[model samples]
Structure formats: structure tokens, C-alpha cells
Target: MAYPIVITPEKNNEHYQYLVFLPDFGAYCQANSIIEALRVAVKFIRDYALINELPPMKLKLPHSTGEQLVTFVNVNLAAKKGK
Candidate 1:
């Protein structure tokens, strides 16, 4: 499944460059780049799905600023299980 994720650039933080939010799961992760953010988000969703029931995909996304980006990360749970 392809899950929606919101990536917002962090200005003050020195450790990370972006804040990634998984609205459906009400979870968040940090990364230094957009590519890394998506990677972390995908791993998080896969791990969360392994332990908990997946929530219904939200059609509406949370509010974001002009610099924030919204994108999708595709994950295949069935394939993950085989690993």
C-alpha cells in the first residue's frame, strides 16, 4: 500500500533537516533529506503494521506550510513478511 507522508523542513534544528509525519498513524520521524525521510517513513509504517492493525487511509491530509511537501511511500507488507 502507498501511504501518505508529510515532510516539513526544520529550520532551527541542527540534528535533522526535515520532519516527516505519518498522519494515519499519528507518528513522526526525522531525517536529513527528502529521500532519507521517505525511507525512514517506509520502515516505520512496515514495522508498525507488523505489530498493529493498519488504519484506514486518510483521504484528507493535515495542514502544511508552503515549504512542506506531501508525498506517498509504497510498502508491501506481504513481501516484507517473507524477509
Candidate 2:
């Protein structure tokens, strides 16, 4: 399933470069780059699904500023179940 993620540039934060938000799960993660952010977001969603009932997918995305980007990250929970 593909879930919408909002990526925002973190200002003056030395530890990470971007903040990735998963609206459906009300969870967020940080990474040093956009690619890494997406990777982390996938892991987060997978782990969340493993422990809890999956949240309903949202058709509408959260509002983002001009500097922020909104995109979808695909995760295959069925494939993860075998691990």
C-alpha cells in the first residue's frame, strides 16, 4: 500500500536534514536526505502495522509549505510478514 508522507526541511538541526511525517499513523521520523527519509518512513509504517491494526488510508494529504514536499511511499506489509 502507498501512504502519503510529508517531508519538511528541518532548519538549524545538526542531527538530521529532513522530517518525514506519516499522517495516517500520526508518526514521524528524521533522516539526512530525502531518500533516507523515505526509507525510514517505510520501516516505521511496517513496524507500526506489525503491532497495531493498520490505520485507514487517507485520500487527502496534509497541508505543506512551499519548502516542504508531499509524496507517497509504498510498503508491502504482506512481504514484511514473512520476515
Candidate 3:
């Protein structure tokens, strides 16, 4: 089951770290760096699924909000990342 993992950096401190939330496992992690946090989150989710013997659940991608929010880069540069 593919799930959505939302990784949002804290607004007050950008470089401090990232806050990762895995809703499927109801688990969260705060790491000194983004990469480390992501790695832990994935490992936790995998272990949880295996131990619980829960079948994979299909995840529906969320839709973007209609509101136009301000972003750091222009659309062209953002598009290059394939959003």
C-alpha cells in the first residue's frame, strides 16, 4: 500500500530540521536533517506494516487547493522539478 508521507519544515526554524508524519502508522519523527528523518520514517512504516500484517492500502493523491499561494520560485523553475 502506497501512502502519502508529508514532510514539512518548521516555519520558525528552516534549517533546524524537518517534521515527518506518516499517517498510515500514526507515527512522526523529528530529525536534525531532512534526509535522516525521511529514512527513519520509511523504516518505521515498513516495520509497522510487516508486524501488523496489514495489506497495502491504495492512497489517493490529494488535490491542490484552489488558492494561489506565494512560493519562492517562479512557475518555470518549479515545473522543472516535476512538482
Candidate 4:
């Protein structure tokens, strides 16, 4: 199953970080880039799915706040240690 992940850039932090929110899991993952964040988010959801049922996601993506991004997390990916 695929999950919707919203990427929002962190501005208040000293170093730039991307915040990944998985709406279906009601979870978060942080990384330096969107791809990396989504990758992490995918792993998160997979782990969560193994434990509990996932929530139904919205058919439409979230509206961008001009500084944020909307993306889907594909759960099929195998994790690489350094990715």
C-alpha cells in the first residue's frame, strides 16, 4: 500500500532539515532531502503497518504552503543502510 507524505522544510533549525509527515500512520520522519525523507517515511509506515492497521488516506494531496511539498510513500522499497 502507498501512503501520502507531506514534506515541509524546517526553517527555524540551524541546519536545514526536511520534515516528513505520514498522514496514514500519523508519524514523522526528518531528513535533509525529500527523497530521503520519503524513503524513511516508507520504512516507518511499513514498520507501523506490521504492528497496527493503517488509516485510510485522503485521495487528494495536501495543499502546498509555498514552502512545502506533497509526495507519496511507496512501501515496496528495501532499505539501504546509508540511503
Candidate 5:
């Protein structure tokens, strides 16, 4: 029941950096690589769960229209940590 997170490039000026946005949890972060972006997303999820008293993996946000088209990013903490 996890929500999809969106990742976007910094801008036309800088394509190497990226921003991660979690629409359901209302969290975001920036990183230089996809792996780093996932790490940031994982942290954001933890913080959000702790502060909001909601389980991170139990919330699924419905997809909605009227939003910018950005590719959704999948976060894998175990893979990133070499687990």
C-alpha cells in the first residue's frame, strides 16, 4: 500500500541533480543520483511515519490528474545499502 514517489531533474540548467517528491506524505528531497534519491525518500518516509503516527507502507495515495507529468521512482533501501 505504499505510494509512488516522483523524481524530477533539477532543471534545464542542471540535469545531474534530482528531486524526489512524495505527494501522499507531502515530503521531498534532492540528490545527485537515483540511489541517493531513494535513500532520501526512505528517510522521509521514516520521519513522516514517526511524526504522523501512520505506518509508512500502509498508505496508498490515489493517482490524480491535473499534475505535471514526471516519472515515478522506486525506492529500495535494502538494495541501496548492499543488503
Candidate 6:
């Protein structure tokens, strides 16, 4: 099953950075930087879903309004490493 995933980056005080992930079923994760953040985020989602016996997520990025929200659809997890 393919599920949508949204990524949003926010900077607090120009020092602290956080990325928010809005996956399917309201599954969300936050971290710093796209690379490190996603690494942990994916693991978190996987573990969380497995714990709940949920299906695999396809990973999608839906468009969102408001500032600090970076949305992308069908983004390859590997591609995030470069950013």
C-alpha cells in the first residue's frame, strides 16, 4: 500500500532546525536536516508501523500551505541524501 508523506523544514532561532514528516494515518516524525532527519524518520515510521502491524508505506509528499512547509510527492528516499 502506498501512503503519502509530507516533509516540512522549520528553523527555530536560526540555530535549531527541525523537519516534520506527515505520513499516512497521521504518522509524523521530526528531526534536523533532510539526511539525518529522514534516516531516523524512516526507521521510526517503520518501527511504529511494524509495532502496530500496519502495511508498508509508499511515501508521498503532498502540497501544503503556510510557511516552512516543503512538500514533495513520490520522493525517493535515496534522493534525499543529496539534499
Superposed model 5: Cα runs more than 4 Å off: 12-16, 55-83
- The root-mean-square deviation over C-alpha atoms between each candidate and the true structure, in angstroms, is 1.6, 1.4, 10.8, 4.3, 5.3, 6.5
- The TM-scores, one per candidate, come to 0.89, 0.90, 0.53, 0.77, 0.57, 0.53
Candidate of highest TM-score? 2
Candidate 2: tens digits of C-alpha lDDT, residues 12-64:
99999999999898888999999999999999989888788887887677788
- Clashing pairs for model 1 are none
Point out the worst 10-residue segment of candidate 3 by lDDT. Answer: 68-77
**Model 6, span 1-83: residue lDDT tens:** 33445555565536436656655656666666766655555565555555585555545556676655554323343443454
Q: How would the candidate models be sorted by lDDT, starting from the highest?
A: 1, 2, 4, 5, 6, 3
**Per-residue lDDT for 22-66 in model 1, tens only?**
988889999999999999999999999878998877566567779
| Per-residue alpha-carbon lDDT of candidate 3 for residues 1-83, written as tens digits (9 for 90 to 100) | 35655565656765656676665556676756666666666566555654576435546443323331211111122333456
User: In candidate 3, which residue pairs get closer than 3 Å at backbone N, Cα or C atoms, i.e. clash?
Assistant: 1-56
On residues 1-83, what C-alpha lDDT tens digit does candidate 5 reach at each position? Answer: 34567776676536458777887667777878777877677777655545576435534544544432343444444554568
- Candidate 1, residue 7: the lDDT equals 100
Question: Residue 33 of candidate 2: its Cα lDDT?
Answer: 95
lDDT of 4: 0.74
Superposition error at 49 for model 3 (Å)? 3.1
Considering summed lDDT, which 10 consecutive residues are worst modelled in model 4?
A: 74-83
Candidates 1 and 5 compared by lDDT, better number: 1
Give me candidate 2's TM-score against the actual structure.
0.90
Clashes of each: 0, 0, 1, 0, 0, 3
Q: lDDT of each prediction vs. the true structure?
A: 0.90, 0.90, 0.52, 0.74, 0.61, 0.54
